[model samples]
Target chain A: MALATLKNVRFAGMATCVPRRILSNINDCPPSLRSERERLVRNIGIETRRICQEWQCLSDLAYDAANRLIDQLGWKKEDIDGLIVVTQSPDYLIPSTAIILQDRLGLEHTTIAYDVNLGCSGYPFGLHLLGSLIATGSVRKGLLVVGDKSATIKDPLFSDAGTVTALEFRENSNPWFFDLNSDGSGFKAIMLPVGGHRNPVKFFHLIPSEDEHGILHLPTDLILDGTAVLSFSTQRVPPAVEKTLAYANKKIDEIDYFLFHQANKMINETIRKKLRLPEERVPSTLKEFGNTSGASIPVTITARLREKLTEGSKQLLLGGFGIGLSWGTAIIKVEEACLPELIEA
Target chain B: MEEFIEKFQEAVDFQDPVEVTENTVLLDLPEWDSLAALGVIVMFDIEYGKTITGDHLLKSKTIKDLFELTVA
Candidate 1:
């Protein structure tokens, strides 16, 4: 249980960008799977998703989001003392996306910048880091950019998104609470088996294997064990959220919204029921965003709760789980001005 | 667990739901595939209040074995 609470740092504002190109799963379904398409769509909660264009990458979306947020908040680029981009998909293996973003966003040269490679649980995890940095007073304000284009292939399992969240020092003593956990033993539960240093892509990695449904995927392709992920979600997330709420001294009814990672419909519904939250309080973007990896939570926030969050101050309980077999829960107060318009690129 | 066979028959998609039995081997059914396996997990979670992993579904040789795991 990796848990911590920090003070004097609140989520200042947030903006998200999803590509304009949409892919409808109905059209993507093949002849054999046509009959099961409706049921699959209902279970997954993804009928259509935004897939990026060939010229676009996660960085492009993240940059667009960051640029919009900075402009919305009317902050000088020099005032952004830190920048961190969290994602598994990077433009290159060498230069960190944060460094490139710093140059692209025109932030001061003295700003702290880097990247954290994570998926699914990356949003609250990014918040955890930003809270720690702001508490240390080494940086007055920072930008945490999270985005991913993990499903730029033949799979309808994921959609692309980028989110930028502003974290700044505030005079208010409001606390930001986070609970982070990881089970690396189950790292293979959701992963790309090849293309890393441990398992470089070889010729055989490109070889395709047919599943029972006759879907063919290369060995290098990202794999998702639905049952395994579901089991983990059912067993882990509720407890983590409950424990974090206790740590933050919050009651369930006191929360205005419980924004969970938009992994899909089934897993999220199960968790929501277990937590006894009504449907209206739990917003989902799976139908449009389709598991945007680390960007899921923020993307869902920007897509579904943009109006509610921008209208007034609200207490939010955010939970994210998957990949790394990791889970994170955060309870915080998001003020009315802390939300920006959802940007579409 | 008496309704297990009926549930399995529905998800298995056999021509006749009556043909499914506790003793029926899962892979022997034409409809028993990855999708069916996931459906089984969902059924156990929602109906039986059991969390079944993919490995557990694969290890269960027959409908009876899966039903018993739901109890276990």
Candidate 2:
């Protein structure tokens, strides 16, 4: 029960930046599965996805997102006292990406910055991290930048984008309720097996096998056990949501929106039905972005709920599940006019 | 139980409309592959209120076998 309720911390606005390159599974589907495109679309609901160019890194997209929000909100760079970039993808192995972005975004040396290596569960967890800090009075205003260019590896299951959320400490701000859970036991369920300390990428790791459906995968490519992942999501997310709502002492109908990680239409829909939520309450970016790893939840916000977020304040219950075999739920309020339009880099 | 056949027909989507029954062997269907098998598990869970595994779907043989797994 990793639950926390924090006050005096609040979100101001968020901006998302995605690469301009769009790839389609219909076009990119491996030769073995060419005819199954329509069926795939119906099940997963991702027709097109954005891909990062070779020159663009995760930090590039995140920096663009963070800088854009800073400019839009008219915040002086020095006023921001903390930065946290959440992503499993990083530009270099040595220097932390968050540290680079602090300088790249022109924040002062006193600002706290670091990276959290998480995938789909990263966004809200990142928010929870920064919000908790802001509530503790150690930092006043902070930038939480989250993104990953996971699509660069030619794997169609992933897309890439970055999102930056601005948070500030204020007296009497709405409280943020959170329940975060992680099962390292399920880490192998969604993972990149090689190119890490456990199994560094060797020359032999590049072997490609074209499946019966024509999709080709390499040894170094991210390995996903779809069956295990699916079963985990179906079983875990409902309870996580229930306990999170219970911790927050809120009912399903009381919340204005029920947003979950845009893992796919199938999984998200299952969780939605399990909770008995109406379709209108759960928004999606899976169709446009096709599983943007850490960026999916926030990307969904900038993509779908721009008007609802901008026109009026809304009480939101957001759940993010997958990769780290992690899942978390948070109850936060979105103030009126806090979300900017989605942008392409 | 009879309507389960029609629902099974919808679940294991075949490119050709192959009539299915309790005794119809699933391996004989054209669309019966790993993807469609996953689809069957998804359908059983969502539509039939039966939580099934990929391995369970793999062990299943006939259309009726899948229906039995749902009820089991």
Candidate 3:
């Protein structure tokens, strides 16, 4: 007798938030500063950036995206049985962002709401988590919100954005084959030096310094060893993708589209080359928007889906990797979903 | 002396006067938190190579105690 095989899961609806405020790569800084960081920004594959206003928070961006998704699908907030927000940025340091989003969306008290602290790889991980909960009959419908306000870093490398995806449980759906990996050793590759229990903020006084590049340094700022991160991504991501495809009993050629975390233009291109994916099949948003951390992959998917890029695509190999030194990939089929466009009000 | 106090006040975003008379409870200030503790620790560590932990913070109650800890 043959073993029972689960059917493939499908994406239903998607929405993304890109802040109205645009910060151009050259205009944000003076001409003198531009010449120095121009090559760096270009090498990273960022063009224009988006950021939330002074009063807006990560939850606000997420709420907007989720609301858009609900409006487009014509589904009530009560229809969502589970809500998971994958974010490192929260309105408050204590209460989880997911709970805040739940309240903002007017979800019922019975809805499961929680926040998962992740960075770039959050989207795929969030999907896997949602799929598992729904597949087990725990929840019929789920909302996965991946958002980040890397703008708090005050660095040009990060942008503020969010993406919300709606997942519905079908009677018989294909099991979303997921591959998750993490390496705590590389945690320091991307981190904020202050603002955590590991190093309390009260003990330090701020001092300003200028490095050789004249970049200002402060005690409570985000620091990224760019070279180190790039090297790690280029070396680890392709192999991880290959491993995930093998686990799914699929081949690189079998994947209709490859959705990778929009870390940077070069990194994404490098991974695509290593995977031997056709340039046209790889979806990217890093050129227009800088790295939005957890929101990267979903926002790209939402944008592409809105443009009708994958209307009848059969298979998608999605992967996200960065921060936490974490990586996750999954294969799924796209359904005739009502993907929403950003409505300016 | 006043310059150092001003730097400390600006760093922590505390509006308290820049007077270091020695009785001010550093933790009692409204701006005190784990993040602020880290900011102060790194500031003093970079300046004086003195590392202060949460346990060390619990032992010291006043600004003068912190100064003494660092200078000692």
Docking class of 2: acceptable
- For DockQ, candidate 1 versus 3, the one ahead is 1
Query: Can you write out model 2's per-residue Cα lDDT over B1-61, one digit (the tens) per residue?
Result: 6777766666656556777778878888877776566667667777777788878977888
For model 3 chain B, the run of ten residues with the poorest summed lDDT:
B10-19
**What would the per-residue lDDT of candidate 2 be over residues A1-345, giving only the tens digit for each residue?**
499988998788999999999998777666556666667677778878998888999889888888888888888998999998888888888688999888888889999988888889887799899998899987899988888888843454689898999999988988899999999998888888898899998988888887766556788877787777877888789988899888888898889988888887778887888778898888887887899887888898898888888888899998888998898889998886467678888
lDDT for residue A79 in candidate 3, whole number 0-100: 78
Alpha carbon deviation, residue A108, candidate 3 (Å): 0.4
List runs of model 2 lying over 4 Å from the truth: A27-32, A152-154, A210-216
Q: Each predicted model: what fraction of the native A–B Cα contacts (within 8 Å) does it retain? A: 0.29, 0.17, 0.00
Q: Candidate 1's residue-wise lDDT over A101-204, tens digit each?
A: 89999999999999998888889999988878888897899999988987654566689899999999886757889999989999988988898899998988
Q: Model 1: which docking level applies?
A: acceptable
TM-score of chain B taken alone, candidate 1:
0.83
TM, every model: 0.92, 0.94, 0.77
- Return the clash pairs for model 2, or none: A30-A214, A32-A213, A32-A214, A33-A213
| Model 3 misplaced regions, further than 4 Å | A1-9, A152-154, A203-205, A210-215, A343-345, B1-72
**Better model by TM-score, 1 or 2?**
2
